[model samples]
Target: MDLKNLHVLQQLMDLSQDCFLVPGPVRMGQPCLNALSTPVMTARGPEFRDVMAHLNSGLRNAFNLAPSEPVRGVQSWSGDDDYKVVVVSGSGTAAMEMVIANRFRSNDLVLVPTNGKFGERVAEMCQRFCNVKHLKYEWGRAFDLYELERQLERGCYESLLICHNETSTGITQDAAAIAEMCARHNTSFILDGITSVGGMPVHPTEWKAEAVVVGAQKCTAGPSGIAAIAINSNFIERVHAIRDQGDSNPNYYLDLVAALKKGGDDQTPWTPAINLAMGWGAALDVLKNESNKVRWDRCETMANGVRNLFLDLGFELLADAEQRSSTVTSILYPEGIDDAWRARLKEEFNTQVIGAQDHLKGKMFRIGSMGETPISEMVEGCKRMIECFTQFGMELPKVDVESYFK
Candidate 1:
């Protein structure tokens, strides 16, 4: 209701501001957007094949397919020779559903640890295809590895599913340890790292996962409509086995075997989002310019800055300090703040953050710092949040957000 604050907020919204702080479908940058605007390529043609080859390789390298390669200069876009990536014409949910539908059968016992919403979704998706055992934990909390190992010791499961970054709660599981347990149990592992893979240093292949599914949005800095799944030789063998026995999943579009068949020639079984794929290649290129560690550090720096801003403003974070995601921060509103703050933020400053769902509603909001979001954008986001707070006539404690970030 402050006129002066409203004027400043309007200026903030118009100040060359274009960045996403709500996780997926982040800014694609000018170059990638330009690529998207260009003519669409034939999904299976020579020109498209060449570029897709590069995208595949860049994607594998970005996902840490192998040990850190020599700090090679930017030369070409060829992917890792040892890895194979499938580009699905759907969101991360599709890729995840594919992994579940293809890897386990109705009789196979599958274990899922659900501490957050994404993990729960994975569990729900698997219920139709496999016999699921829920290792449930409270939302906004980390999973218990001891219990996970005990579940593995039961040796009843043939597949294990986990979300590396549970976006809803901003919790990142210790995938390394989970992988070790899955390996020991001789279980097929599927890691849904939709929000974690590019924003953190994760070695999914080396982690012994059968598949690691990530999306073009979220940490990849591309638009939605495409998801990438990296499959290991072990998983590919299962696909071959299923195909040989004439056993097919009920869902044809989400069939991993069909995807793998086309991926052999760097193509997809169905028509892909060609322009989005092209843009995804550029996004992969941007991350491949430096070490994955460097990119992860960049995301973490912005995430920590956002976290510090929330903490300094007396807001409690949802996840534990050690297990919080580097890509998004789930923040509990400070005292005297309510859910209406979300509408106020958007209306006053064109600023947006995700509010929690179901039970967590009105308890917290999520701010993303992954993809193309750098420190400057996070600083700007913090400024806008402060302005939104002041516009609501709430007195905040003396906290110099920028100086704190500095």
Candidate 2:
């Protein structure tokens, strides 16, 4: 396939022949692809309302926001019915900004902790909306809880924003501990679970988070440009208070109050990306049917396999071992390897992977373990990577890639 001659949309469809392992948007399954082909319907019609209802139900389940006990260590909450899952026709950042706009006032003090690119992004977004106290850390390192506690003790923070999964550096923060801390301080917690929600376990209700944002393209294996937010009763109450004060939220298109009003009838305030919503709904259904434990175990197995395979081949991981994410694995390049190695893996082996962002480019690469990628394809991709390393004049050892799966 001469990719250069093809249209950009055609190129997106043509790529990823053998192995699709980018962090996100990860490779989607056939069901989601079929859903994306469905004909558009009226946003206010009964048919679209049915679609919204289905999508909302599945999304609530995916976030562990519903009154369910099958998820690990989660109990039914009485306020479950008061919770709302709002879908927006934008990316995950849009959802994050919408929640921030509605939840915090200009005088509110917000604490933001950063360890990766997405964490930095949350701080950047909060700065525009409120008084932000930013905490910076080394990329791929875990946050210090004691320091966070000290900050909360000293500052009168109205809320704290953090990313549960830092996909850029493949790190998963200790969200349960953070939530507990937030509860003790009586501060609202806002979580960005873009890459963690469906691929692993996330209980917004149990965590007492005010709002949790998730991207459809990440763990859900759906098309891009769709995102959802899970909000609690307290969040809605605060949003109403903000609205009663009159136009405190400057955003017009990404207004959460308007979204909540329309959500009562299974509708959005404006025209939505109807096809993306269809595909997202189908992807959520698959995640629910498979159950949370099954999906978490599969992702854990794939992550361990990818990490072990790379370790045996003399590569180092970027994130700390204890905090590494199960959905995305970041591997540092060995002595003789460079970014060209990725091109060879894509062109010669038809395998797709992600390069590092910002200053880490050429120093590390990321491989995704989310979605429904088969174990056979991951094994083949690992072997191809080894072949490329050998071509770069690094003598490699014989690795039993299948043993990792076993």
Candidate 3:
């Protein structure tokens, strides 16, 4: 984790290519670099207001929220008031937690699916305030929809919590299917789209999602310390009802009522990381040039190329073919190779892939092709990986980089 060590190590083994293939904080080009040089602006100032509008407009355009979209109750936000985008001063998890704190109390019944780390995290975070019914599944396995329907029939849950893209296991759940299921059961949908939103297509209106959370880092191609929580207009009215009736929430920073009140003026209750917010706005502006479809296609191409590279090298993938994530790809390392194999990727090849989480530690490795990471990096890294793995005694055929560029 030492940057100094990595800096010295990058010049080794004639592997000069540096590919940052972790889930996030992704690489943002010049716009991001330019924002860092800007002085911090007051959250309530006109300059910050314009930047906030720009950032929210990008989200609006990406989600395709227009006059056609049905919005009710929430009308304070600018533009069409289709969706209320709450910019919080924390990592993606902050937005995730905000959804729980704002929507549910101890009396509310929340259903969560546990197939990966993020799903488990949301369930755990919700447990602090509300009743959570955990739907368990084995890691690396695709979600069992039949079982989910069975569970939905078992209880009258207030809201169904789901993570659209579970980064830990590289599985992107089908949102439209889940949304339809929720509609059938008369339940509101809350999605954790931290790894998906900007990198993939997200339909807030079509899916009928109540509130969804995303981070600046992962697919947004920005720095951390900010999480964007989007809530539909209908849900915002319910939030006001909670506050109007004096529903007491002990937490100050995450108090939905206070945040929503401040958000009406394009501001936060507490001082935010202004520089990072500015950088996030810049990132959104950069992404505006190309369509989200193209961005997602680029990510998928790189991901497929990387996955094929490892698969061709005789390494098995962790996720199934149907549910594989376009942003992050996790592959199981063979029996003999330990953590050193991953370390060698950084020190020897100047390429950094993600290490595995609990139970699969040292046995799995992940490569990120999300955000601004281009197909060129995957091609270069895969070729270098073939050479690196050969040194680890796992010899395999080389990848045809030219052919794999989709």
The C-alpha lDDT values of all candidates are 0.78, 0.84, 0.77
RMSD of 1: 3.4
CA displacement after TM-score superposition, residue 304 of candidate 3 (Å): 1.7
Looking at candidate 1, what is the lDDT of residue 302? 82
lDDT of 1 by residue, 1-406 (tens): 5888667756656645643578877777776788788786677786776666666766776677752222222222224434567778899999888877887656778899988888999989888887889888999788888998898999888888998899989989988888888888898788898998788978865787788899988888877888888877778787778767766457788877777766656667888778887888778778887567888998888888888877877778999888988898899877667779888776666677889977888988889878877777778778878777776676778777667555
Off by over 4 Å in 2: 1-17, 67-82
TM-scores of the models, in the order given = 0.92, 0.92, 0.91
Candidate 2 lDDT score at position 20: 85
For residues 1-406, write the lDDT of model 3, one tens digit per residue: 3667545544553566587888988877788879967977777777766666566666554444542121222332335645777788899888888778877756778888867898999999989878899887777677788877887886679888988888888888888898999888878899998998877778888898998888988887888788788888767887777667766344777877787777666667888678887788788766767778788888888887777767776889888788888899998878788779878877767788889898888888888888887777877777666666776787577567657766
Q: How do the residues 1-406 of candidate 2 rate in per-residue lDDT, one tens digit apiece?
A: 2445334523433335578888789887888999989987887787777777777777887787654332211322122565678898899999999999989888888999999999999999998988899999999999999999999987599999999999999999999999999999999999999999888888887889988899999888888999999888899999889789874758899988888878767788899788888898899888888887788888888899999888887889999889889999999988757789899778766788889999999999999998777677777677767766776688888888889976
Whose lDDT is greatest here? 2
Model 1 misses residue 265 by how many Å? 1.7
* TM-score attained by model 1: 0.92
Name model 1 segments beyond 4 Å from true.
Answer: 2-5, 8-19, 67-82
lDDT of 1 at 385: 82
Better of 1 and 3 by lDDT: 1
